[model samples]
Target: MFRQATRLLVRPISRTGSRRFSTDLPVAETADESFVEAWKKVIPNIEPPKTPLSFMQPRPATPSSIPSKLTVNFVLPYASELSKKEVDMIIIPATTGQMGVLPGHVATIAELKPGVISVHEGNEVTKYFISSGFAFIHANSIADVIAIEAVPLDQIDSSSVQKGLAEFTQKVSSASTDLEKAEAQIGMDVHSALNSALTG
Candidate 1:
């Protein structure tokens, strides 16, 4: 029993497992210098691989004074819609509910669902329908939004959205398997959001 416990304790730590931590919040320590130094001593020819957190640029710290405008950076896979554009406010459809972000908002990372993101600039408001993605609100009046797929409000086809909603509604009822039902439900949810974005 003593020998088995010693073996378990002496086992090598997995580099893959060590890199699996969430990147939503800021990490105080980017790299373990002691571990790297040990690795260098063991294998002098090869350097240790850097993790994703190491490559990420450090964000600005929270400001003491609240700014008047909120800077937004909205990007998709293929295009960047808004890049450091200052806006009055942004209303995001978060899983918890509709979240309104203003200047100097507390730092938060939100998993976004299928819904309309309303970007308000004084009297003018621009809207976009996001399929799914995340929103990272920084403490220094900066909001970074990235989505899998995002379409402008006016660019979406309302008639096709209504048709898809009807199709998915029927699919949800007729689905035979659990996986099928879940997929159908997801389809229905997206269509529902699109329909609401158009009408609402």
Candidate 2:
């Protein structure tokens, strides 16, 4: 009679969802190594399309030029009735910073902060003030801006706008950092323009 010795081990899955290696021993002694190699080489047939996540969808190529159609939304009261013909691009006060969205932009959702929003169509520029909110932009030449509070330049009170500018100027003068000073200056300029638009 002859006696044989064998070793076996088991390993569990890893934290990253990968299987852990077990000790090098099989429960069955007659297992064929060549058969195991053949099985490893075989891959399950994938569907003609959408098999893998990467191949499930086709990616769009980058556009060479801006689209002809453009749409924009403003948070200011009565902004819905504003003319869309004079606006080609919008400058939004985003939470991270101001965002300039041009036509043919990819879809995106962003949080906005309280600051000035500007619109530029050709050489003409229009500005507005928006209190914190969110904005959404889509590839279909549409932009939506929703803010907690908004007042168009022409609708704001002149005295209040002047007061805001004066305060912004003082803040700019007292700012300790370049960033602070720059922000304050922008605020002052935006407020001034709002006042001009209102009182003019």
Best by TM-score: 1
lDDT of 1 by residue, 18-65 (tens): 542334343324234444555566656876656455676666767789
Pairs in steric clash, model 1: none
Give the range where candidate 1 is weakest over 10 consecutive residues by summed lDDT.
21-30
Root-mean-square deviation of candidate 2:
15.7
Return the clash pairs for model 2, or none.
Answer: none
Global lDDT scores for all candidate models = 0.84, 0.62
Measured by lDDT, the strongest candidate is 1
Q: What is the TM-score of each candidate against the true structure?
A: 0.75, 0.45
TM-score of 1: 0.75
